[model samples]
Target chain A: MSCEKQSPPELPGCQEANGPLDFQLRILSDPRLLAVVRCTVAEFAAVSGFKEDQCRSITLAVDEALSNIIRHAYNNRRDQEIEMRLHADIGCLEFTFVDRGEPLDRSKYCAQPLDAVALGGRGTHLIRQIMDEVVYERVSEGNRLRLKKYLPPARLTP
Target chain B: MTHLLDDKRDATPMKISTRELNGTTIVDVTGEIDMSTSPGFRTALLESLKKTPRLAVNLTNVRYVDSSGIASLVEVLKAARISDKRLVLFGLNEPVQEVLQLTRLTKIFEIRKTEKEALEV
Candidate 1:
């Protein structure tokens, strides 16, 4: 929590020449902050060498994850706190979200049938579709959601 | 800059404006469409559908859209189908288009590249 602290200990190996190319953002569960967070994620993804389209997809996946945390985990309460950490390298980008809210049900982890034109449970579906790996764990205090998007090695165009 | 976001951080979260062109209802959506703003989008869509069967959504300015947002649009499409109406979309930026493609909803919706083409449909 100290302002002088640069990066968390968990992200040691992910540092770069300019220092750790990682960011940790902590905010209340306010919907207004969504845009700022999305912008930050997009910029971070761009810095990690993702293409513009890939950055956008990463942003949307993170947005949906945060929205689910705010709505389902906190039950639309804006007073709760949510923490997001971004770690990236040449091969992949990982996002970890921690929230002091309700635990997610294991039964709801699966994507629902898309045949019906219903509005429920599509957030997780999109998250699964956009990200290569999605992991959810319930902690003693709340929950943790980790999403990873794989980036293939850059290819040379002859 | 944060100010760009500040400009869009209004009391009304998402801006959904509508106009008519050549008998087609065009809904112009600006700002992020997520869980918080999808309700307003639903209202705008339902209101637009009440007036006409055909709805054309212009999403050029939408910076972000999550699954809930997509669901709202799907709800609109479902209602349109049941009511024997038509729904066409144009001006979808890359992110929106990618989401639709990933969900396989692109094949389900009538998408065009231009408003003129959408109106002609």
Candidate 2:
């Protein structure tokens, strides 16, 4: 079976946490999904310990990674459903994108940014610089890319 | 993965506000930049280049940029290289700076961290 045809391992936080303190988002590859995901992150920020900068990192990373899939993985073809899941938990958040398509060229991508300023190649680069940790995997039917970013360790205050 | 945002407007997110400072037209951009929006960005920046030898772009309000944003900037760079005019970036946000660093583009163009610095360079 293609990796996409298989289900993802149950995510770490989504299956464990509950409350106004947490969030989980799952949406198909539609570009409009950014709104719902951002709103969820906003909610996590408002009620939990995260600040805006931390949230924006996740948002932008997700945006870039997904944009890459939209542009290259699926090649701007809308027929594929880009699935994303965000889990905000204890000290950080984890975001995942799953799509059943061809594997990407790892060599073609570097988290490092370049200034040749070509129009089409910026997507993968953006995802690496902004997010704390990025991992790419190929499961049975599809490709999985996950990003994780940590909030500052909680401060000890008076 | 399908990362396309489903905003109804389909209008480009980048906005243009131009000011003539020291005889150069400085175009300030504010908003999210992407494929849907970068073409407009390219259009606006290129238009500014036509009328002046010096163009300063203030990117302070630009919240996010993607390949398209870089492309638009590159477009300006190409124009500057060919025209022998100067195009500079001012008020680069962290995300923008991060993009430049990864691309190693800082060496190619004059970048100022603030509007004042950009104007001076």
Candidate 3:
């Protein structure tokens, strides 16, 4: 885990003169690290002014995203590396995940319908429901996933 | 509680212990249930289900759970139903409860407020 302050070049709604707060974490793809990552993200969201419930939701979303990377991209390879970056501005929080593993198949990434009682497909659904924006792209090296959650109107100002 | 069937304490992030209470099997789980730990949870649940027709899970100490953990419960529930066994879960914290609600699985599983209630019904 590392923390640094940098101005985001093209973020649309950043209002702070100092720029958005940024934190970066690099960890192995081991599932044991999920709990540690969740704790860090939860505290980071809280420090960025999200309420408790919002913090929990954001934490869960990040956890699910990392879990997906470990399962689908890395194929449960424990030694693989995953990098996560979080940017907090006045209007929204953005998370970017980069992994050097197999790119996820977009056609197969759909969340299963909740009506059916099934196993193993609800993670993607939770991620979609919790985050306001989710985008995935395959880079030359591997994959990148971005998730954004906007703050409420009252909390939008610095 | 008369017999302790299995008590698993390992290097993993979660701990599971099972005991027989009257005629029902009670599984007490402590720690986070996530991708790293859900497999152990599923194994414990399935092993207990095979031993008793009635089972209740005590989640009072579980403060966090993810979709994988919930999926484990769903899998065990499905197996229990197939074998005409009853599975009940109780003592869910807010985060765990919200996960269940978000997944719309709160209605599918038999949930109770306490072990007594879970065992009785």
Candidate 4:
């Protein structure tokens, strides 16, 4: 067996000029990285003025995304990094993960409906069902997944 | 910016917040959510479920979350299913998404593209 390192490219979605909030991290594809990203998310949300329940959901979603890269993408090998971005508008949030390696099975990700006791195939399925918008862009270099969540727009004028 | 707070040793650089949208509870978390902190994440989500049937989680602010966090989520998702409540996860950062995809548990919960769609579910 051989270990190879593939440097990640500059991810596209993070540079949004008008997004209300955003976070970007050059993360090593490690289980520990999930915790690191978790901390980042918590801090970001706190500063962004998200409520506690909103914080919990955001943390959970972030955990699932980063863990997938460490455990699957690099197969827990110490060779690659998962570039990450988290963004929040006034009433919405966005999470994007970019992989520098090969592309994933697009059709295989059917966005399965929720069912208890089902074993696998729930990763992309869940992401698709939960986020308000889910978009996948397959670039020449790698794959980029963008997830968005919107709360009801605040009624400040009222 | 936080360095000043660290120097003063008087300010907590991170915090947590939650809100109810329609029938769903939305948590926009921001902090270092690991083993110790993940419990807070789990508790907050679970606690809200006791009061509401719909739950939407926005992961746009969370910077870091650990395996314990994942475990906590699995529990939350399981409980939500058992109670017949609708819970959806939205706005997953890259690191979070990778973890879910690898564990093959991403199939277990509803992760939508945006909060708008999640609430509609």
Which numbered prediction scores highest in DockQ against the true structure?
1
Better model by lDDT, 1 or 2?
Answer: 1
lDDT string for model 1 (B12-116, tens) is 557988999988999999877877788898889989998996899998777667787888889998889989999988999877887887666888889999889
Candidate 4 Cα deviation (angstroms), residue B1: 26
| TM-score against native, each model | 0.84, 0.71, 0.88, 0.48
Write model 4 residue lDDT over B1-121, tens digit each, in one string: 1211123321332356789888788877765555346667888878987888887878765554455566678788888888998888888876567556545567777888788988885
Two-chain DockQ for model 1: 0.41
* Fnat: each model in turn: 0.51, 0.44, 0.63, 0.02
* Chain B superposition TM-score per model: 0.88, 0.85, 0.89, 0.83
Question: What order do candidates take by lDDT, descending?
Answer: 3, 1, 2, 4
lDDT string for model 3 (A1-158, tens) is 11121222344565553356899999999999897788788767766667677777888899999999999999999999999999988768999999999978777776458646988788888899999999999998789999999877886553
Overall lDDT per candidate, in order of appearance: 0.79, 0.67, 0.84, 0.62
Top TM-score: which candidate number? 3
- Model 2 — TM-score against the truth? 0.71
lDDT of 2 by residue, A43-158 (tens): 44433445445445556567678777766677776668776666656555677788887788777776334545565566666677767898999888688898877656652110
Ranking 3 against 4 by lDDT, winner: 3
Candidate 4: what lDDT? 0.62
Off by over 4 Å in 2: A1-36, A42-48, A111-122, A154-158, B1-12, B17-22, B93-108, B112-121
